[model samples]
Structure formats: structure tokens, C-alpha cells
Target: MQKHALPETVGKNIKTKLMLSATPLRRLSQATATAALGLTMLTAIGTDPAKAVNLKTFNISGNFASTALDGSIGLPVNLANGSFNGAYTVDVDQLPASNSFVNLTSWNVNLVNENTVLGTLSNSLAGNTAYIQENKLAFSDAGLLTNENKNLYSLELDFDSNFTGTGITNDGKFLDNSDLGSVKSSGLTAVTFVKIEPVPEPQNLAGTAVIATIGLWLRRKQKG
Candidate 1:
């Protein structure tokens, strides 16, 4: 379901300037067609307590400005147009204590396909509470992981750990009447990074107030 809205400002400055990576092979834009993420390898990041960090959002975007559908090879995503967005948040607390994939309350992506195929889909996307995990994030249609193949329009996005330097690594499948005829399914990809932090607690003004009151009382006593 929809959660926090993705931040619109995440990758504003770098949109057109991001040159496509120099990957040599060509890629197809179809849902079934998988592309290599990039020279940086994507590995499954396990639950490491030492590396755990607070829940944060990631805004992912890139201009597909190269020929042959060239772009960064990050992980797959939920069959999504919304799920695959510029602003995506995830919670990565240390395991056993508690952890989850924060539902994206809102979604927006800045994808300019300078070339072609495989990008964000429609709003039919949804997520599962069970898919939440330590150092991981995931989303799909309304049901379990297995049901993705059956939906009329569906997509999936899985992130190993958004806290890393390369940004959110994603893997996913997508299906729409346009991509697969009547077949139901989903996937898209983006690799930019942004995080949301809790607002700081208001300064401890109560103590200052009490001190001021005492000082006033002392002054009054001296005057008397």
C-alpha cells in the first residue's frame, strides 16, 4: 500500500548530467528481459548488527540517456511505476530487536528514457508486511511473493541494503497488457540515494524557564 511520499528534491540537480555507464552489452526493455546492473557487484547484505542503521528513505533516479537502453545495473524492483520512484524509504534496524521495509507512503520517479524499454509501471503496486527484514526492503502486489505472476498488472522491488554507498540495489519483475499482452505480472530500476531523519526534539526550554523564575524570585526577595 502507499506509505510516505518520495521526496521530489532527491536527484533534481543530477538528472540530465548522469552519463550512462560504459557497459558493452545491449539490453531489452521487456519485463522478461534482464539487464546487468553495472561493474559494481550486488551482493545479498545479511543482518549485521554492527552495520545496522535507523530507518531512512532513498530517492532513486537516473536519465536513461544512452543508446541500447544503457543505465546502472542496480537490483530489480517491485512491478511498479509508483514503487519504482525517486523517493523510497526503508527501515534497517538490527535484527531480532525489530526491522521492516517501510511502506512508501508516496511515490514519484524522474525517469527520462533517452533511449528505451524497462521502466516504472502503474499505481497497481502494493506491499507485504512479511517482506520486511533486517538490512533489506521489498514490495509487490497485494498478496504473497508467489502471487506476483498472477496479477493483471504487477511489479516487485527488492533492496539488499539501502545504506550502502552504491545506493539501493534492486531486482524485480513487471507485467502489463502492453509489455506482456494479457499476462499479469512487474519490475523497474533506479539508483539514487536520499535519507530522512527524525526532527530533533525541541530544546529543553522548561529548565531555562524554571531558572528564570528562580532568578525573578531572588530579585523580588532582595528588593523586599
Candidate 2:
């Protein structure tokens, strides 16, 4: 068996633990004695690729003012005026370009008022137009060089403007990102633009957060 660097106290414990499976130590090179102790730590470092973040499911959550738009719509819960949770999957294991807009393969979001999940809206049903987009570059509209910029730290989601389907309220209205979240001068938004982001992996012993992005964007949902 191979031995790696480990502290003296832990090395002794390993020596006792691995005795039945391995040979007894004939001599101590100080480093050779360190065997069996660092197996757990070494296995973790060697198998990093297998543990990399392949970010498959996205969990979305956000709040709306108590006086937003759902009141007049007659939803069971005031989702437009309160908070809700939604999620989506692109079926692919990657993200879109920082400046590109692409449709999601499927999505599911709760049509929740302040305290109730009236229903869940999903792509399995009709009118599920979910997409992700970001604007990392500043564009010059008519050569004026607009100073506006979308966040590079977080990704945002938008459904079709007021997509009405199974979740439509009594008045025949649904709550979505109604093309209102404009982070740039170009003016683009939906019923709501809730930020999407990857919950960062806990820092390693070296204090480094290993964030493996599939494409780009989707780091954290901090608006710029």
C-alpha cells in the first residue's frame, strides 16, 4: 500500500486500524508511517472530477410586493403580490451564452399566493415558454453607448409575457414575467424576472469555492 503525508497523531490511529488488512510497519521513515491515515483525505482529492458540479436542477424563489398585480387577477393565492417558488431544467447539461436567449426544455413553478400553492405550472402542459438569458456586453443603441448592463453574477428567468394556461385565474389571467424586468436601456422583461443562480459549493479546506459552470452565467442571482 502507498502512504501519503499525514499528521503523527492520525498516523498512529491508522496504523492500528489497517493492521488486519495490511502488513505491520517494519521501520518508520516518518512519511511511510503516515500511511492509512490520509486515505480518506486523499480519496476525496483524487475523485474531484466525479464530484464536480454538473448543475442539473435549478431551484427558484423570490418575493413580490404585497400590492403587486395578482389581486385583480383573482388567483387563489396572491402570487403576483407575494412570493413563490419555481424550477426548470434545460435537458442539456450546460447553460446559454452570456448574451443569448434560449428556451428551456421543461419548467415547473408554483402558482402560490401569500400562503397557498394554488397550482403548479409546468411545460408538460400548454403555454410553458420558459427561457434563460443574460446581457454581459454593453450595446450602443444608435451609437449612444448605453451604460446599462445585465448581471454577470446571476442568471434570470422569464416566461412568456402573461402566459395564460391552467393557472389562469378567474378573470382569465396568469402571473408571469410580464416583460417588466428591464436591466438595460433596450427594455426587456416578463411578468417578473426572478434571478436564478447556482448555490455555491461549500469552500474547501483551502477556502476556495469550486464553481464549475457548464457554459457561463448562472453563478449567483445578484442583479447588477
Candidate 3:
């Protein structure tokens, strides 16, 4: 007995289904490769050194005794992962001056549960120089400044007697004598704290490398 032949439409339908299935697999592979390449690029970006520097600015505006002081202080820090672990710089600019000499001897940076002393900038001006001065203070131990609380920090300025003047004043008192008295500036009128966080280096270098390798493989597969 002769078997009936299959219909032509049946063969066409089977061929169409097989083609559709193959197309989906190819598309899925390509999509996976594209995603891997994107991940690799992100890893490379995370490990780049150029993006690891963070800059912040704090402004102090208020009266220091009878003189009004206002300026922007720059804080440039290097971060590893999410923590500070490198050299940092504090730049003071637009310092205020009055008829009497004003010397900034030291500054105290107060964070949560910790206080840091920044003392005697290398280029700090002293004596009876009645002029505005700018200073740059560099510290290598910025890791100590980090705190879990990211709130605004306070700055306290310490001034020696030389800040007033070196000569004897009308009251027959030597204004520049450190033993006589010292000045501390606080009670800021306007305090503005700014924090800038740059892109940090990858915390896990090995993981990043593995991710990059996988991404490269995916890209090659896509190209092939």
C-alpha cells in the first residue's frame, strides 16, 4: 500500500518554525555580547586614574572681630573606592584684611567625632603685614578626615597676637605679643560647604579585569 504524501503547506510551516527558532538564538547571542562589551567599558572607566580626584569648596563669611572676612577655601582630595586615601590640598583665597595685621596661624577642621589640626602653612604670612594673604596647605593623611556622616564640617581659625599688629597700640599694650592674648574666629555669618566626588578607582581590580576580559570576548563573538 502507498503512503499519502505530506501536504506542501505542512513542509512550509515546519521550515518557517525552524527559521524563527534559529533567528531568536542568534539575536540573543548578539544581545548578550553587546551587554558584555558595555560592562567592560564601564569597568575601564571605573579604573581610570584621571577620574579619581575630587574637589570641594567651602566658603567662610563673617566678621573676625571688627574686620569682615570672606573667602572660598578649596579642598582637593583623592579617593580610592569611596574613602579618602591620598594626598589632599587646602587652598585659601580672597582672605580679608583690615588696618591692623591679621595672621591666620592655624585652622581646625571638625568632623563627626574627630577634629583635625592644620597648622602653619608653608607660605603663611606673619608679623605686622597688613595685606590679604593666600595660603596652600597640603596633607598626606586625609584618610583621618573621613567620617561615616557626610554632613557639613566646621572650621575654626586660630590667630596669634601678631594678627593685630607688631607695635604697641594706643593703650600702651604690645599687640603682637603672643603671650598677651590670642584670637579665635568663629560664629560665621554664612558658611557654605561643597563636596565634589570624582569617579573612584575600582575597588576590586581583579574583578574589573575579569569583567573586561569577558566583555572583550563578547565583543569578538558579536563581530564574528
Best by lDDT: 2
Specify the highest-TM-score model's number.
Answer: 2
Per-candidate TM equals 0.28, 0.35, 0.24
**What are the runs in model 2 whose C-alpha is more than 4 Å off?**
1-55, 69-72, 91-99, 135-224
Tens digit per residue, CA lDDT, model 3, 127-197: 21112222211111121133432222222233334221111111110011011123322222221221222
How far does residue 216 in candidate 1 sit from its true spot (Å)?
48
Better of 1 and 2 by TM-score: 2
> Model 1, 8-107: lDDT tens per residue?
6755535434433222222234322433433123333434444544654444543211212123122232212222334443343432213533344334
lDDT score, candidate 3: 0.32
- lDDT for position 177 in model 1: 22
Full-model lDDT for every candidate: 0.37, 0.42, 0.32
Could you tally the backbone clashes for each prediction? 34, 13, 0
Order of the predicted models by lDDT, top scorer first: 2, 1, 3
Choose 1 or 3, whichever is better by lDDT: 1
TM-score order of candidates, best first? Answer: 2, 1, 3
Error (Å) of candidate 3 at residue 223 is: 72
